[model samples]
Target: MSTDKEDLVVDDDFPITEEDVEPRIEPAKTNLSKRRTIDNLLEERRLQRQLADFDYDL
Candidate 1:
């Protein structure tokens, strides 16, 4: 039993080819803008709720 590094055998067909992989797709700009708008609205509502729940008495 030899523990040499070069003892392993690599197959030529084992490497991945360009055709076998799928291209990465990015989200549309409109969708991202809409998400940002929704996020801002939600944050504003949260802040308003926090302000309403605060006690003003010393």
Candidate 2:
């Protein structure tokens, strides 16, 4: 068992290209918008539940 650095072997079959490394902006924006919408809906629902549970006699 040799611990030399030259013993490492890399496979050339799978190479990283520019398209694979580039960031996709449009999909990310849509996903973020959808996530925000869901978050807003959840917050609204939670607030409504709290309002329904409030003690009006106080």
Question: How far is each candidate from the true structure, as Cα RMSD in Å?
Answer: 6.3, 5.7
By TM-score, who's the top model here?
Answer: 2
Model 1 per-residue lDDT tens digits across residues 6-35: 766767778688988998666788779989
Model 2 TM-score on a 0 to 1 scale:
0.55
lDDT of 2: 0.90
- List lDDT for all candidates, in order: 0.88, 0.90
| Over 4 Å off, model 1 | 1-27
Candidate 1: give the clashing pairs. Answer: none
The digit string of per-residue lDDT tens for model 2 on 1-58 reads 9777686687879978998897866787899999999999999999999999999998
Q: Candidate 2 — which pairs collide?
A: none
lDDT of 2 at 47: 100
Clashes of each: 0, 0
